[model samples]
Target: MIVLSEESQRTSGKDAQNMNITAGKAVAESVRTTLGPKGMDKMLVDSGGSVVVTNDGVTILKEMDIDHPAANMIVEVSETQEDEVGDGTTSAVVVAGELLDQAEELLDQDIHATTLAQGYRQAAEKAKEILEEDAIEVTEDDRETLVEIAQTAMTGKGAENSKDLLADLVVDAVLAVKDEDGIDTENVSVEKVVGSSIDQSELVEGVIVDKERVDENMPYAVEDANVALFDGAIEVKETEIDAEVNVTDPDQLQQFLDQEEEQLREMVDHLVDIGADVVFVGDGIDDMAQHYLAQEGILAVRRAKSDDLKRLARATGGRVVSNLEDIESDDLGFAGSVAQKDVGGDERIFVEDVEEAKSVTLILRGGTEHVVDEIERAIDDSLGVVRTTLLDGQVLPGGGAPEAELALQLRDFADSVGGREQLAVEAFADALEVIPRTLAENAGLDPIDSLVDLRSRHDGGEFGAGLDAYTGDVIDMEAEGVVEPLRVKTQAIESATEAAVMILRIDDVIAAGDLKGGGSDDDGDEPAGGPGGAGGMGGMGGMGGMGGAM
Candidate 1:
């Protein structure tokens, strides 16, 4: 209509649905290959020439600069999964995409979008119940089970070759931070050092400050050191308002300078009086203060991060004093040894052997930057899963066992539902099989063959049946030490179903302006915007290989 703006464009009915579904599915396919232990990685490079080589689903999706509305929704699924469990981001997105695929098929059969959405919602609720029923109960006190959970999460990741070592460290770190309130993963900090291999990573009894002593004249190490943490600077404070000092004589100017020095000296004196041999300053330390600190034989680190200060307080059983005047003897934390060591040609401060430290750090060593980075990501995911397992108090068999089990149960559920919605439910059941199928496909196994094998096993009441990607065999995932936090699967199913249902119910798409159509330069084909190279979603022009991920 002439009344409409020139830039506004709209597509209704089937065309709109297909265009949306196609974009969403394409986004899913982009990250599909990077799933499972056998999955490949995607190297994402930005316009700034920064490169990220990771198989992690959320990382890949986040790096990609997608603009398509439908495609962006798929990315949200990954984000939500990551936020909830810090694991299974890929699985969540993949499941959502597959759900859309299934919905498309049902739509082709003349099943209304409302019917599909309703069935998907029902199936999602039932899936969570099935997951809960099949889950194995776990507790925070179960160390062995927790270790296995950590190892399973790290499986097939970059650190898998040395997962045994890292898993032990992760489990220990998580357990160390676990209190009556539950595990606070933030209490566990990871410090990366390039030189040693991944297996060389160790759980530090205390914090590692990636900083050196403020002065070289100070002692490199202290035995049974008492630590002091300050949120304020050790420098002389200036007047809040601008004021001109009337110094009529040179002696008066010298007196003003001496007063500033006295202030800095007093701050250092307070630490010495409190028997503090080490100081971590959140803000800058004045040059004079450094001299005083070194003169007092105290190992002081300036510009320490606030987080490090908090962890230091936890490790040392000390307080982070905001003011020098307020500091007391009890404000000091303890470390068996605080030393500055040269690591990989760089100096770092280590606060080690804190007695019964609630805060612990993991020094992750690797051969190179990329290696260390991948290790950090792997351990991060592992820690998250282990912590989540402790929090949820339940877990499910991994390696697609939960999906396989859920699919079998849903079929039985679909049989009980009446009306045309039953077909939607059945289709949802088939969609759940995509996980196991993709797992087999990524491992170079026959998808159909694996599906049949899984279905046959589940038909015989083997609820724990799953694909062992390494061997291309169907086996008991739990017995094989392949388990995942129950929240991971539950959240993935629920989030995916909601996303899929939302995308499915959209029967119309309207842009702010008369949107141009997306086209291919090679053959000038519009595969997505509208039917057969027509006008529609032009803003999605770069989405085909968007973010350089696809």
Candidate 2:
């Protein structure tokens, strides 16, 4: 019979629960202060001295390098929230920590983990229902409302100063890429370039090629461009198997070179015959072919990346042709203009004013690298919220309005399900108030007073009322133009509840011994009957020795 050794470390019941909850709360505390519009930023430095400064929840948690399995689960909650809604990551983590906190209190009162898990799951379902019922419908033509949603997302971020301009650009970019099927964010590209003011950022009606013209002799600009997307290289292809030609006479070698040149010339002749004014080649272009194309007054770009080629095809209404011999007039793309311009000592190609482009480009300009990066993060948040809004066609008031309303409704729901589970449900409701409380605290206001006022106002039929973290005043979020997509709140609640339940369900933890250096003391004294001692067994004998000694 196989016998288990008593020397193995095992933690169960209250000990395991306490340890997991402590680790989760510690992680939550690390990011709690970075919650609201007035939230402070965290500067994380790795062992190698690399630094990252931001208030983004997922970024901060991901950089922390958490070790505890339970804590990592909390981090996953934030990550899942960010992946699903693209915002409210901090709120999700904070709520999850609070749920565990409340669960600990219930555990002290002899409440089973299974009971707590069931209540939390039920509360999550009701919270999602509340969010959907409270959402305000928005139409595609509501440009003003859409702009407000974008501005609200960008507020208190690096892009606040230019939020109006950036919001307008974001709205236009989303609309430009929206089709009958749905909105595809991949079609809207955001390109960041430093050394310019933010106001200089503009939207291009087509794709922006980051490369320069292939030949210097080619025209700088081509109007009424007929673009051809070549997936193959312009150079002559060698045979599949290697073979060398031996020519004893110099005339035979010259003839071989002339034939290669003739092939390149004919390739260029084919392009000119098909009325191709510009070419975007996915592979290298031979020097001879470049010269011939330039001589024919054709614009060409070589070494285009596959992603850029795809975007070009979408913007120009063309297909990527793999074989040059199969090139036809129908395979070509139409563009109003294709030009090359030099900015900051770098050449960039612009394919602009396509006939009916489903893809658009937003060029972001800033004074420095750091500024541009922050702006990109801000714009990313804006774009995500806009896309969510367009897809769901529903939105909720921001600035903690949804949380306050949800809390009030959930309390009444708890009363209906009166039992031990009712206590857990009520705890879930109280946990949600963390959002507004943190917002108030971050804005330098009295959290207790703010919560009281918010609850009272919400109870008095002011469903849209929320704390304006900027001024610490209770105002109607809708009237103040503070709004967010309904999915953000719903996603946060669902993820936080699921994580809390998963952690609460754990009742036992068995940790394996460290196997790297073997079980030896710092004094270098081996126990009696250990592996090298009287017993012939190795590590297993050491375990028996430890049990006997203890």
Candidate 3:
């Protein structure tokens, strides 16, 4: 048996639970103000003094460098929300913190951790049922509604002012890539360029290549283009292994050079023979080949990345050929036009108007790099929400509408499952109201008054009723065009409940003596026996168990 060191610290039972609950709550509080349309932005300054200013939940939490294990779990919840739906990250984190806060009260009332865990699991399942039952079905013909959904997700983001224009682009991009297999977001690429206003952002019917023509002498535009996608270089290949070619005679050396030149010419000839008016090569093109290609008036781009090549193939309806010898006219892809254009001091190739094109690009323009970056993030969230809505074929009202409805229903669910588990379920119902409450607080309204009014409206058979942060009134979110995909809300609920339960189940804390760091408490003090702190108690230090009863 290993001997216990005198410096080792242990805090078990109630002390451990309280510490974890406090840490989780503190983390929730940090992002609490950054909720809803009126939410405030956070400026994160790292040691290098590089600053990030945004209210995006995942971005803020990721930049915080959290040390407490319990708080980290809350961060993981936001990450999962972002990874799953790309929005509602703040809602998920806020809900999780509220769940822990509610659980702490139940724990103080002599409730067991296992009972709370079991009740939360049941409540989470019931939440899914309620959401599905209440979700509004959307079909392919509902373009206006889909645009509204996209606009809702983009509101309160950097691109909010351009929501109408950006929403159209997002919906069009999603619909273009939608297939029986589902929406392939990979098919939709967002390209950002600084110097233009946000309203100048537009969607390209085909892919935009950042690289320009390989040779200045090559044609800048090719109409009714037949494209060849070459996976290999258009140059003579070197021997796979080291070899010696002994040519003592000058004439023999000339013959060897002539053969190499001939091979390169044949490669270009093959592309021409296949009716390829434009060529996108995955590898380099020999200088002689470029010269020949330019002489033939064929446009060519060299050293295109693999992803670009695949996108080109999709946009042009062409197949990538590994060997030029196997190239055929039928193997070539077609585009209405391929042209090189100069933008922001850089040359960009535009492959547009392909028949039945499956890939597209959204070019985002802004006055500054920071504005463009935030615009991209905002558009990303909109794109993700639209994709999720199209894939699931269902959506719900936003602005805390679904959360309020779910809270009202879960309380009834709790009564039906009466027992020690009932309290946990009831606590979960109360926990969900945190969404509307926080929304109100962030909007500078009375949170308690907003929540009470929201519950009253929800109870009056108004399932879509939600707090209008701008007006500080409960209104129909659907009528206001505030909507989100069912998947986003469901994902937030599942991730938040699961994370809260996982943290609530902890009951013991044992820490190493030399640990000096732990998650910060409300006062910003490091908990005793934290990750790098000396042994002590309270805060996350009391919650961190050192290889014991995790």
TM-score of each: 0.94, 0.90, 0.92
Candidate topping TM-score: 1
Enumerate residue pairs that collide in model 1.
7-513, 7-514, 8-513, 8-514
| Residue 391, candidate 1: C-alpha displacement in angstroms | 0.9
Candidate 2 C-alpha lDDT tens digits along 1-550: 6344555556578766766675566567667888877888766666566666677788777876655567778889989977776778888999998898889889999999999999999999999998898899998899988999899878776788999999999999988888898887788888888887998888898998899998999999999999999998999989999999999999999999999999999999999999999999999999999999999999999999888888899889988999998989999999999999875567899999898878889888889876787788778888888988999999999888999998999999999985799999999999999889999998999999999999999999898999999888899999888998999888888898998899899888665642212123456463222322212111212222221121
Candidate 3 per-residue C-alpha lDDT over 271-357 given as tens digits, one digit per residue, 9 for 90 to 100: 888788999998999999999999999999988888888888888889998887988998899999999997777889999999976
At residue 60, what lDDT does model 2 achieve?
73
lDDT of 1 by residue, 113-163 (tens): 999988888888899998888799998788888888888877767888998
Candidate 2, superposed: residue stretches over 4 Å from native = 1-10, 511-550
Q: Tally clashing residue pairs in candidate 3.
A: 10
